[model samples]
Target: MSDKYTFLTQAPVHRVIGVMAIPTIISMLLTSMYNLVDTFFVGKINTQSTAAVGIVFSVMFFIQAFSFFFGNGSGNYISRQLGAQNTKDAEVMASTGLFYTLVFSLIVMLLGWFFLEPISILLGSTPTILPYTRQYLGISLLGTPFIMGTFCINNQMRFQGFTKYSVYGAISGSIINCLLDPVFIFGFSMGVSGAAVASVIGQICGFVILLIMSQKEGVIHYTHRRISFEGRFVKEIIAGGTPSISRQGLASVSTIALNSVAGNYGDAAIAAMSIVTRISMFIFSVIVGLGQGFQPMCGFCYGAKLYDRVKEGFWFSTKIGTFFLLFWSVVLIIFSGEVVSLFRDDPEVIAIGIQALRYQMIIFPACSFMMMANMMMQTCRKTIRANILAASRQGLFFIPLIFVLPYFYGLFGVEICQPVSDIISLIVTIPIVWSAFKEMR
Candidate 1:
């Protein structure tokens, strides 16, 4: 490792976290840009088409949640092993995680491809939005393996403290996605399929680049040698990573629940909710990116038994993430209507979307706490607690809130559910923070 990246193993907590987080933040922002760029192109087609993109987000997140479960789970374990000077264990974790991701993604692709119509319908596809949803989902599903594999590879690299390479690979993919969006969507008149195709192509490019670079960089090996699944390795990976999986997996579930509620108001409501979600995600991605940057430092410090470093890393990451997100949420709140209108010009959709976005902005900062806390706890192997909190934001709390809230407040309730759950999760996270920091300090 270079002097700069030496923070992965040994460095002052603040500096180490900074070194690790910048690239991750860039990568995460770039990742979000892929979605935004696609949203921009899809928005040109009409409100229904734009909403189709949002409709399919839950399915994508579903696939991603599983991939994250294994990839992040394994990566977290591997990082700690490396920190503990268990290189072989780290290798095992890497190989096992990659294999698991490939297998899971292939299965998801098959299911999604075969049942595209029903799946889309189930994901909140209104009759007007069904065609666009199917078109985007069909092609996007085809790229599931590539997307999931690339995600796994990136996580592995980040955990191994090769974050610069991870950033480069992701940036390359984002650029390709951005460049291809206009070409496929407009130039070829493929519409939603065009967006899906562009996304897959980008993921493939990213996977290839990371695979080759990983070998050259000696970060991890992708060899013809058979990778045997060790039970212990799997257990360790699953335990450490389950929190991430629950966080993302539950997010997928939460999205579905959110869509179901939005569906009650008709296509316009679906479209409106979609725009609101995309806008919120655009802002939230930065916070997530920064938190991801701190993962390596947290894991390494925990592994090295540098408890003080862990506390310092957690505080710095939380402070910076909160500050950035607070500023963005304010901006989003101020121009909430404009932001919603950018995705769909339909008057009714924009009206609902503006309301949804405003509520989301109000709850945005509270949401950050659960996210950052989960990252810290999971990276340090406090899996069970992390998983509970991770599941809270979208799964446990969101499911009930979305269901019950809509009954009382109707559409407004549906729009406000996520932020409410986020607030609840944030409140719950306080004790986790106090105890974690107290112990570490």
Candidate 2:
């Protein structure tokens, strides 16, 4: 434990974040593949199947919100506790976070089963896409508890400076999902349902591997006996995690709103937009990976009251993240049509998706700063500022624009909504981030 704390505090900021970012970057890409792999295989079956997976992705995001809420929330507290040499509190938080994540995810699964069809419709499923969406969503519900649990544990593990396990666990599930996708979707003739099954199986594999990794030397152990329901422990998790949940939960909401708006054009529009969103996320994983790496270091430095180190790490990561995204955005824009075509070959889908993808890519480089700032704020316990920035992209800006923009520009409005939101959110992020750094001193 002492060794881990020393590494987080004394290690050179660039070297430490680099060591952390490598595995986390790979892990984030693999995690995104959980959706992209399914999208890739399901597209072969038909556009409706592709659309089904996309529609159900909102539920996956919502489930992930719980994981982030528990995982990141607990992780922030755990890293701080370790920094302060408070081992007992760290153990209790590890167990408590795991226990609650399992319970909450199970509840989500049960509630989803009762309202499956309504959710499918609400998530922008057209009549043709309804049946396929139901099949995919039904099987996906069964895996919620496991996937959410894995996500929580993964975050906990990364926060401990054991990010190699995160990469390994993510790789295991991604490989399994990739191998199983074709076999189940084609060999078993299961269609969209098969894609969902592959994802669930992959998630279960990840969950099992992560559980085993948690027992590794120098890592925190999760046990029921250590679980705490005390207000102090609970509040710590809430304070650290609220920003993550706000971001992810509102992502689900914004996606649902985007789909509903796109539906007016046709199922083709829905599929195109869905593919575009997935593509954007895939490219943006680099930023998320960097933020993940920055978080643990930020939390530890702030906890130890090495505030200058925390500030330096944030700036270093933000610069690196923005550069990487800038490079990728240029590449993606140059080949936007082919990128969208790789997911689905339909002329209409590709055409609509290309425009959306290109527009989003234009603003993509700006998101890195937004994310790094939010993570820094959340780790430093600047909850209100962090939550506002977290919610700004989807909830504060995107949701309202989705409804208002279409009235002015129709289908073009839907295509441009997210980029416009990113711009506004980027503007809002500057003042909040500026205020946060000032408050930290």
Candidate models: Cα lDDT each: 0.82, 0.90
lDDT of 1 by residue, 325-355 (tens): 7888899888888887777778899889888
Off by over 4 Å in 2: none
lDDT, model 1, position 156: 84
Given candidate 1, what's the lDDT at residue 280? 79
Per-residue lDDT of model 2, residues 1-441, tens digit only: 788788889999999899888899998998897788889889998999888888999999899998999999999999888888888998899999999999999899999999999989999999999999999999999999888998899999888888888677778888898899999999999999888899899989989999999888889987889988899989999999999899999999998998899999999999999999998898788789999998888878888988889889999999998999999999989999888999899999999999999989888899999999888888888899899999998788999999999999999999999999999999999988877778677
- The numbered model that scores best in lDDT is 2
Model 2 residue 306 CA deviation in Å: 0.8
lDDT at 191, model 1: 84
Supply the TM-score for candidate 1: 0.96
Candidate 1 regions with alpha-carbon error over 4 angstroms: 1-6, 224-226, 438-441
* Quality of model 2 by C-alpha lDDT: 0.90
The 10 consecutive residues of candidate 1 with the worst lDDT sum are 1-10
Return the number of clashes found in candidate 2: 0
